[model samples]
Target: MRILLVGDEASLPAELSDYIGDLGEEWQVQTVPDGNAAISAVATSSIDAVIVAPVLPDLTAATLLGQMRTLRPETIRIALIDANASHRPPSARIIGMAHRFLPLPLAPEVLLEALTSLEELRELLDSPRLRSSIGRIEKLPSPPHLYLSLMHALEEDDDSSTEDIAKLVAADPAIAAKVLQLSNSAFFNNGRAISDLRGAVTRLGLATLRDLVLASEVFSAQSLSTTERNALQARALTASRLAAKMLPESSAQLGATAALLADIGLLLPGVRNEHDPAEEGDDRPGHAEAGAYLLGLWGLPMPIIEAVAFHLQPQRSNIRSFWVTGAVHVATALASGLPVDEQYLARVGVAAKLDGWRNSANDLITLPADA
Candidate 1:
């Protein structure tokens, strides 16, 4: 992995060098004093990732990230900002530009975690067959008109209101319905129901509603059959809600989004391999792998792609923590009425929590009938 640091971190080079040396060959780090040099390196070299500081001498981090996105959409872009940096751009704007928003005076481990995520994602998805499957896809989810309108209103208008966003969503009947349905999800119940589109938009907030619009478009994308597609989508949505209930509030959104898109491969035209299930015991890739590959190709954040890739096979994750992947795996299983991997859960030290999760699922009406 070659990382480009676009900041004035003096000690970062030595610290990162010590760590990178231990990782052996194929690891490189280069630092540039300002955004112009960083852009030059990025344009000329096969840079895998770029980390920019909040304050830049020549260019704003946002402008640099935007430039990187245009140059190499596949590059994992990150912003390192100080929490106390008053001039830092709005987090929403930065998050939209960069895959991650790391804090300043960065810890080596935190940066390492970001790099390791990329490695793990490659380990899970590196396959010639998977590449061919994704290549066959003529197109992926193109943001619908309403979604574009929402983005414009948020970006161009500082005072964009919930009602204004709701109006944009409501213009497209499909997205509005999904947003309303998601807001009324069993996991998000706020005592009273959300019957109006504006109310639903308010409940979910702008960022979440924006993501859901994309998800709704993907689920409703043309596939083999509407009946089959709707079934997969409904099941996915149910698992999404269940997955959210399994994790703490901090990770719930990631868990939900990952679960919601886990079966995307099955719906995509050329991504699903019929022989995947039979070859599951081997290293053969499956729908989970294919969907993850698609997400990565689209330049999504690594954590989301990682969770989608490993949601069904938590043991393959190697890490034993109850991360987004574990939540998605168990929730998806319970939603589909498939047996949760008790052994895998036990291995992760989360087995004792399964019964409680099961009980909670039992109380919800979202879980689809035993598939």
Candidate 2:
């Protein structure tokens, strides 16, 4: 991977260069003294990621990263800021620009984890065609304003109880539902459900819920018609619940999230492979890869991404045992009123459990509809 480092030569991390060199021969790192230099480098070459320091010679970190938003829109951006400074706590806008933030004088472990995530995403999205298609995603919904309010309330008021936070999210039902969805998913919860918004907020605490609420922005279905949006939401909600039932305790949360977000790609334009005839036949089916790509880009866990990416084609995955991908495939098929892949299931070692799984999904047909 090609990386661009932006800041003063001294302001940047001291051992960062040594760490990058240790990553191996395929990695290349360059330091740019200012925002203009960083922009020029990105424009002239292919840089997979950029790291920013608090002080840039020509521009602030946010300004440079904001410009990079268009220059290499898909490139990963990380900022290392001194949280202890008097003028600390960057604005939400700045926080939003960098995919992840690290304290300045960065720890080697934190940097390694960030780099590993980048490399893993690259490996998961190895398809050049898919990468090109994802690049055309022009309409990423802005981070929700409600989330900003939630963050402020949680941080500023030490007395703010879980109920207070839940009240804030509940004020916007649209955002509240998303909170519950993520809370119920394996990302936040253990294996069981957290049905209420307050419970979700309480379970997620301050930091975890902030990430979930921000992640919820992609769930916005404004691009869809009322009819399409409602139908899809109903299906997703039911599928997520049923998926939770199908998976074992250890895997339920991831399964629910995968099933819920499996169709999220349908909300974005240019998500389908326009030039690839094989993927052009049906947009709905193609949504699996698109949604997975989008989630992968958002830095979700690999299991969730893989589950959504191959929901319709579970056989594409090595089915050693029943897990997130299998649960999502079964639940989504049942929710959509389609037949499960019996032939595939017969070989998956879960054919006997199919009866119980389908029985669990049967009640989902009545869940959000005719209530």
Candidate 3:
């Protein structure tokens, strides 16, 4: 892997250099003093990733990262900012530019882990043709207008009420149905059904509701036949519920949301039926990578992004424990009538729990369509 470090040797701490050097001959590390040199190197070299310091001689870290984003969209971008600087709110521009943020004075082990994870993710999404195809897409789905409005009201002003967001969600039947369905799932429902959208919103809270709406909007934007759309939604809903049930309480919400959006890449322009002759082989980009790429661009949480990217092949991830990716993988496999990978389940120490999860998924599938 080729990494570009944008900062002067004096400013770029020695610990970082020593850590990178420890990776041995397999990794090529280069350091440049300022943004101009960094940009020039990016234009001339086949850089795989970039790490930029908060302060540079000529340009700010945000400016350099933003330009690098346009210049090398495939390259991984990491921002090294002071830990104390996190007290101030980050600008939207910076958030959109850097794929990952590492507070400086970072431990050498943490930096190494981050780079290792990035390399694994790159391998999971390894397809130049698919990257080119996604880049040329002119009409990728946008977040629902209601979602946007709700986010605006919540972020820009404090006057937005739960009732107001609930009403906005109710205005769209598709989004409303999804919210109610998730609210009544085994994870949220406590015996009684949530008959109203307002009650559903209250149960789910604003943050979780927003993610569901975004996922629903992407589903709605796809040009799918009713049967295809319904089948996909059913599988997604089942997978999401199973994932929530299997995860720990703290990460259950994120796991469910990731599973729900796991299949979104199937809706991308060039993607078609898995059995279609043109896409019958592994040469084409699968739904997992495409969905992850789009969501990454939309600035979704990194865990959710990683889950969507690696759900199809969770073993590709560097983390050894059961995380959002593992939950989604197991849930998706069960929902699609495929046997869970016993080795993976054993590796994660969740093999014995598969039977119970399968039962939960079966019950979810048997629920009333409008339930």
The candidate that wins on lDDT is: 3
Span of 10 residues, lowest total lDDT, candidate 2: 362-371
Over 53-103, each residue of candidate 1 has an lDDT whose tens digit, in order, gives 888888988889878877766666778777565233345555456655566
In order of listing, the candidates' clash counts read: 0, 1, 0
- Candidate 1, residue 108: Cα displacement in angstroms equals 21
lDDT of each: 0.71, 0.71, 0.75
Give, for candidate 3, the lowest lDDT window spanning 10 residues. Answer: 272-281
**Model 3 C-alpha lDDT per residue in residues 34-59, reported as the tens digit of each score:** 99999999999878879898889899
Q: Which candidate number would show the highest TM-score if scored against the true structure?
A: 2
The residue pairs in collision within model 1 are: none
RMSD of each: 8.8, 6.7, 7.8
Model 2, span 109-198: residue lDDT tens: 777777777687777667656655555444444334565566557568878888888877787776677677766665456988888988
lDDT at 8, model 1: 77
Give the range of the ten consecutive residues with the poorest summed lDDT in model 1: 136-145
> Where in model 2 is the C-alpha error above 4 Å?
9-11, 60-63, 66-74, 79-106, 142-217, 273-285, 365-371
